[model samples]
Target chain A: MNDKKTTHFGFQEVPVEEKAERVAEVFHSVAAKYDVMNDLMSGGIHRLWKRFTIEASGVRAGHKVLDIAGGTGDLSYQFAKLVGSNGQVVLADINASMLGVGRDRLTDRGIAGNINFAQCDAQFLPFPDNTFDCITIAFGLRNVTDKDMALRSMLRVLKPGGRLLVLEFSKPQSEILSKIYDTYSFKVLPFMGKLVTNDAESYRYLAESIRMHPDQQTLKEMMDTAGFVRTEFHNMTGGIVALHKGIKP
Target chain B: MALFMTSTLTIAALASAEKMLNAALRYDPATRIGLAQLEGKILAVQITAPALQFFIMPMDDELRLMGNWDGDVDTRITGSLLALAQLSQTEIHNLKDSGVTVMGDLSLLADLQRLVKNLDIDWEEMLSQFTGDIVGHQTAQMIRAKFGWAKDRAQSAQRLTSEFLTEELKALPSKPELEDFYRQVDDLRLAVDRAAARVETIINRKNIKEKSNP
Candidate 1:
């Protein structure tokens, strides 16, 4: 008889303690080709989604921002520019491979001085209380082993009145779109992954994990339960992805 | 969400616009340098006819356009699309009658206007990136000559049409003729006023004589 706590790793249930390690392995495998795969898989819609998130962030000069799970420094690069010389942006990721890729990409792009790279988990941020004015996790919250704990940690590090934005895949609103999306995700995505990165299993896990992640309304409730205020969500691409925003009050 | 479609479409449009603008600016290094000076300043453009608002912020040598912005703006211009377009090319003093309203940081608007007026794109250099330098230069020269000839021909045609109408056909008055007509009308108006004053004096004198006889 097994007595250990269990959590969902893709479609399979595993010991809660092992979920992070499994997720890390998946990211490490795909870190180098992550950006390319994202562009190809999403048909470059990911860039538009990320652009929308940046516009919604309300980040300006002289504001500290924390971009958790900021793989390849997409949001962090923009935030560093927005914050200017006086502001700071911390790009934090749990996977060392992803963090290393992000740091190298950002440095190569000549984005430095205001940006910092951190190998830290969202569940236990290493920052002091009330530090960041805004925090964002783009397509990353779904992979978190304990999302509620991560939300709490984010809230703890955010200043009063600061907002957190969560951009992730969610349930589609239309039935037809959902069916088409499922077929594409299960059939086309992994094949492309195999062709490009030679890692079909990781892409399959991505599809399964997206299916297991909470819906838009449920995630809003989770943020509310984590002591956030004024939680709301905006669905993009016909609800294939949603961005949830909550203010720390 | 309705808000989702609006924001998504807006962000996408702004992204494309920014890309095209930066691409054009790449050939105009002077304009790019001028843009760098205005970095971090936000400009809000409110169009009354379409009822749309967007914010423009310059960063480095690029421009970032946003559908929504929360921070304070350095300048805000509210007008119809045509009025705003005219304001960009027209003089600042003419804006009062151009139906454009401007608020905050007048100097910023002046600086932007100056920059826009001074923008000179180097099409030869841009084309050289694709074609060889000699071919690019020859193509650019041909284009310039064609444009100059077309402009000269258009101006000459306009002048000929004006002369044909006013001098030959006599269908419209020339500038000097119109001024002379205006001067004659003014003299006639003064003459009429003088005659009316003389009649009023005679009437007053006749009324006094009648009162004395009574």
Candidate 2:
């Protein structure tokens, strides 16, 4: 009788249309303390993960890069420097609060003249077709309501021979590591979130969302299904986080 | 697991090295300016013994070291770690036989060598930022004087050890004695070649006479 489509927002099932708003509320709540929480939760290993993504991106001078869901402008800051004066970097995020925080942070750091900010959803990118040479969504894709749709949207915006890098949590390779990671995610992360950001529920949702997201092979297959070629993945931190890369043909 | 460990470790190592080098370079403004001039150029260092390679890209007065780079590099040097270290400290032209193979832009390597040679860090000024000016100045002076004394002592000890080995212990050849031995060996090699040539001529003559008589 109530068949209006449903999707997983963390462990609970919700209407497809409400997932985006709910996810936005979570980001809005954590936008101010996002960077601090990231550093604390991952013990600064996220920086190395982003560095690896930057190396794999192959972005040089005079290239257009889009940092989708680029909260806090971490990747955008590096991309702006790498692209030089002639290039452009657009930091796009769905939540206005995260975008505002990222914009203010980057502007305060004097990272202007080659960077722009866009408040747009990943599922329906507002850019023209075949625009960006490289696109990256770090730790943000799992929060997307429709990942397949977002991947196709990214593919559409990428130029022929452009690349898309997805840095997110994935299944661990070893059993023991998986057990430890599970315990940390479900227990330690929420506790830290409560201590730091005073929002345990958002961190709990984060853990659940990462678990609900596709595994490495499944995500690579998803990219293949979304009309991307040369789809491959590199697992970092014993596969607790995987950087999946796909190139547009 | 191996890939994960290797990549994480390599990235961590590169990040730390880059940070330390940049921190040092910050104290040496001349080197930083020189580095800025070499922006957009990439240098690839291939260490053969460990079978490792990394890329160094200079940008914005700092060096960016990466574990993996897929773009075209301006210069590449391949050798063992020791050979590469020697190449960095010595003149690039003088190290032609140092077992380090350099490819691509030779001028870039030369410029980099020049920058390294001219690096003069103001240790006093750098320390002043942390410890007050007087303490920093005294500490720097002490370090400089100690370094100078250590250099003199190291050279004297090296000479004394060489003398003990060659003259006192008779365990190794001295420089002049080694040169004389080399000269004698060369002369003996030439004499042996002349004798062989004369023997060959005599054998040829005997062969010719035997052929005519037969």
Query: In DockQ, how does model 2 score against the reference complex?
Result: 0.28
Per-candidate alpha-carbon RMSD to the true structure: 18.2, 19.8
| Candidate 2 local lDDT, B1-214, one digit each (tens) | 2222237767876787677668777788988899999999999888785566778898888889888776798999899755664455456666567888889998888887777654555656643433457865876676567556867888999999999999999999999999999999999999999999999999999999999999
* lDDT value for model 1: 0.86
Candidate of highest TM-score: 2
Give me the displacement of residue A192 in model 1, in angstroms: 0.5
Tell me the spans in candidate 1 whose CA falls farther than 4 Å from its real position. B1-5, B117-214
Which docking class does model 2 fall in? acceptable
Question: Runs in model 2 with CA error above 4 Å?
Answer: B1-6, B117-214
Models 1 onward score TM values of: 0.78, 0.79
- In candidate 1 chain B, where is summed lDDT lowest over 10 consecutive residues? B1-10
